[model samples]
Target: MEPVVQFDHVTKNYGSQVAVDDLNLSIEAGKFVTLLGPSGCGKSTSLRMLGGFEMPTSGRILLSGKDVTRVPPNKRNVNIVFQDYALFPHMNVAKNIAFGLELKGLDNKSIHRRVSELLELVQLQDYANRLPNELSGGQRQRVALMRALAPDPDVLLLDEPLSALDAKLRQQMQIELKAIQEKTGKTFMFVTHDQEEALTMSDTIVVMNNGRIEQMGDPSTLYGRPGSVFVANFIGETNLLRSTVLGAEGNLTALDWNGITIKADQGGLSPKAGEHLYVVLRPESIHCSATEPTSGNRIKGKIRQRVFKGNHTSLAVEVGDGAVLNTLVHPGDVAQLAGDDIWVGWKPETATVIPDRHAHR
Candidate 1:
């Protein structure tokens, strides 16, 4: 089967400032893919290029095996749900949802049937007569989705559509949106900087940085084994330590942090002797105790602060003059106190060591 969308060596530039740099990617049909990155990282730019709102400075965009590099937004079979919900205040929910159908010159009876189906799909059937202002944040978002899906486009693009809602509403909308997407079986390409959103909603995630794709894969693959330090740090909370690879045999890699020797996983990185490296260890993977650890790779430090989070405890320990390490302790195993000597330990296989020289660059 042909890919639903393909970007081949795509590049977009505004004068000398490149917004998308030599991007090559393909999306299968009916898959949920998200473009995630910080602000000004070109995530939104790439989405605009795909939507035909912005033309790529170079390369081509193919939709369902046809080149759409210069296709106008109206000519492409795609719809977008913007962050602002862009609803006409004078139009009620039903009118807003039917607007797109009317534009396509559909008959009144068919337009009514399609609008009804979309309203039910987004679970806003009861609120159809109400105006956008009468609905809640989540409801407004659903109305926006109904408007976008009313036309039954081949692809749907969401641009931070849930960012305006409160925490509870946002979470509710995430589940609702996922359910609607599954039921419709439409190809979706969402854009957001929220890592948690990308991780939770996407079949595949594309992490972008500085107008370039840093990594792309399934959520579990990106989280469990990151290809670079930027990905490890961006995806979740992690404790990074500067180190050097001493040796490697099989799955284990001997490492040295300054003068302390420890063992960690190679993390698919080929590090020569004396080469600088950084070990990424998730906060929850480290076990803490009042005394020095007798087993596993241990690091001694003084407790700087203890944060109680109800379900878990976060300990900030100062390991060196200005270096602090954070570890998450289970509520049941919360031990030690501030100003006390403590030990943090992690199994060799639990940590991933990658080259550090290029981390900040």
Candidate 2:
């Protein structure tokens, strides 16, 4: 399928400082794609460039296979929902939603019909008469979303649209936003630094850092099989152990973490003996037990702290040499294991070995 949006080696620079560096990405139609990264990671910049709010310093941008690198924001067939909601205080919910339709010279009857449809789409049909200030934060955000969708743009850009809301409201809005996207079947280019939000709402996640694309893939692929050390650390909480490649035999690679040797799948990457590598182990992948299990990978550690998190208990186990391994255990099973010496084990396939670029540091 042709991409709905494409960034061809785009670069954005402010004098000597670069906001985006040689970014090349493609957004498929009807897919919810998220640009995810930390502050100043160039996610928002990439979104802005797509919206024509900022032009790239070099390279081209395409919209539905059309070269729109120099197209003005007003001429582009796209809409944006800003982080602040950007609602007109004087306009009520209906008017706010009708603003885009009215700007395009649609008849009053058509505008009203579209507004009503959008209100119902967001389940805010009763709140159409309410002004922006009269609604709750989530309600106002829905109104902002309605306004953006009123025009029926091919692609909708969301710039941290849920950032202003509280945590509870943000979670609720994430579900609503994803539902609305599916209902409309519009290409969504969402920008945010929230990993959970990206993982929850996006069909494709583009992980960015240092103004460049670090990795892009489905949530499961990106989370379960991160391509780099930065992606492994950024996407979720993982125990990163510095290890040296002891040797490789067939599909398995042997790594030495301090004095403990463990085997991990090479993941198709070949590393010579004595090469520095990082073993990525997810907390949930490690199982904690009172008795030693004759299993795959096992490490003996003293439980320093245990946190009850309703569904699961998070235990911080110190293995030695100032290294602590985090393990998540079932709540019911962790009642008697707090503060005790425990054995943590994981399957060899669960651990991934990636070369560490900053191993010296």
Candidate 3:
């Protein structure tokens, strides 16, 4: 299928500072794609370039196979919902949603029908007459979303639309926003620093850093098999164990960490012998036990500290040369593990290896 949006080697600069550095990406039709990264990473700048709010220093941007790179924001066939919602204080819910439709020369009856459909879509039909200030934060958010949808644009740009709500409400809205996107089947290009929100709502996530695309894939692929050290650490907490590649064994690769030989999944990358790499070990993937296991990938370690985390406990295990690795274990399992001595091991397939990229600047 042809992409609904495309950024062809787009580059944006602020004086001498490059905000977006030669970004090339494509957004498929009806797919929810998210640009995820930290502050000053240019995720928002890319969104604005596509929205016609900012123009690139070089290259072109196409929307639905048309070049809209140089077009003004008001002339583009796209709508944006900012963090503030920006609903008129005096206008009620219905009027706010119908504002865009009316601007396009739609009749009153048609505007009413479309507004009603959108209100019912968000389950806010009863609150149509209420003013924006009178409704709750979530309600106002829905109104802003409905208003953006009123124009029936090719894509909807959301700039941290739910950042204002409290934690519980924000989480609830994440699910609701995804459901709404699925129901409408519109291409949603959202921007945020929240990894959980990106993972929860995006059909494909684009992890950007240093004004470039680090990795782009489905949530499971990005989290489980990260391509770089930055991606492995940015997506979630992980234990990156420094190791030297030994040799490949079937589907696993032998790694020499400190003085201990351990095996890890190769993840389709051929690591040459004597090359420095890091094993991406998830906390939950490491199994802690009081006795040595007669099975896969066993190692001896001392439990340095334990943190109670409600349903489970986080164990900091000192494996080699004061390198502390964290593992999640059942709280009751360590009731009395004979002091701090324990075995922290994991299956060879559970851990994957990634080449060391030094560290992010």
Candidate 4:
């Protein structure tokens, strides 16, 4: 019962720059795991190292308990689906999927059987004879995925594989990719900067920053209880308020933010009195009204702007100290709170507090 993939204190460097710094992670079998971060955050570097495409500067990478840190990409029981799809233009879907199996010296009958099965997996069975150019963007992507999965690697490494499709297609393929992974019961290590993609598809998400992991957990845990200021702002849209801890009572900490007393759960953090901290509130957490709701932390703010976002409206309310709190209110409520001097109220427990070590301001 060992981890299907493990990175033990792995580090990768490019000259003086550290791409992945002393990383340790364990990915179990048959789960969709995503390494998510912005550009140059070392997510791709880590994936490359795991695929044996790049060697780690230090530390070991084990595949199911066997050391494969310095092994070549071809020698490892892993296959990668690059962002470009990497399919041959001249080859049809079946041929592309059969390429790896043929290189492994499988007979014609075996290759055709495997190819047919894969084509059926993606529901592209009818398109097996169609060339890459003849297929849609989503179809071409499925071809690439089936090609990588055709080899039946111990783990499948996807390096932003859905990046090429349109927004709608991308969303559609996210569900498809996850479904395929679950159906095949293959261990998938996916890499992407798209937060929504990771949230929608991954069973676990590893948020990375500056070549280091910021946090790793299930989507709801990371979104609801971010460990750092960077993570709170990165995973989703949030209003971060600079505050000073006034007092602590068990799990709740009183804060003086913008001259208003707000109580937020320390979330296991033990902050001493007068410590500087940040309170993270999601847009949906802030309730907007024209009248004060005799509950929670009520603050007055001028309605600065309202954006129409389909189902709900996004409002920018300017509070005290020139601080603007963004809140997503239902479209019905926007009409009532349209004028100046709107009341914004949110329970203190709705906010998450983080240390100000990496606060950007």
Task: Summarize candidate 3's per-residue lDDT along 16-69 as a digit string, tens digits.
Answer: 999999999999999999999998999999998988889899999999999999
TM-score of model 2 (CA atoms): 0.97
The 0-to-1 C-alpha lDDT of every candidate, in the order given, reads: 0.87, 0.91, 0.92, 0.91
Q: Model 1, residue 198: displacement in angstroms?
A: 1.1
Q: Please give, for residues 157-231, the per-residue lDDT of candidate 1 as tens digits.
A: 999898988888888788888888898898889999999998888999999999889999999888877778888
Give candidate 3's whole-model lDDT: 0.92
- What TM-score would every model get versus the actual structure? 0.94, 0.97, 0.96, 0.96
| Residue 111 miss distance in model 2 (angstroms) | 1.1
Where model 1 places Cα greater than 4 Å from the true spot, the runs are 291-294, 320-322, 335-339, 357-361
Predicted model with the maximum lDDT: 3
**Model 1 backbone overlap count:** 0
lDDT, candidate 4, 164-262, per-residue tens: 889999999999988998899999999999999999999999999999999999999888899888889888899888899999966789999979888
Error of 3 at 179 (Å): 0.6
* Structure candidate 1, residue pairs in collision: none
lDDT of 2 at 335: 66
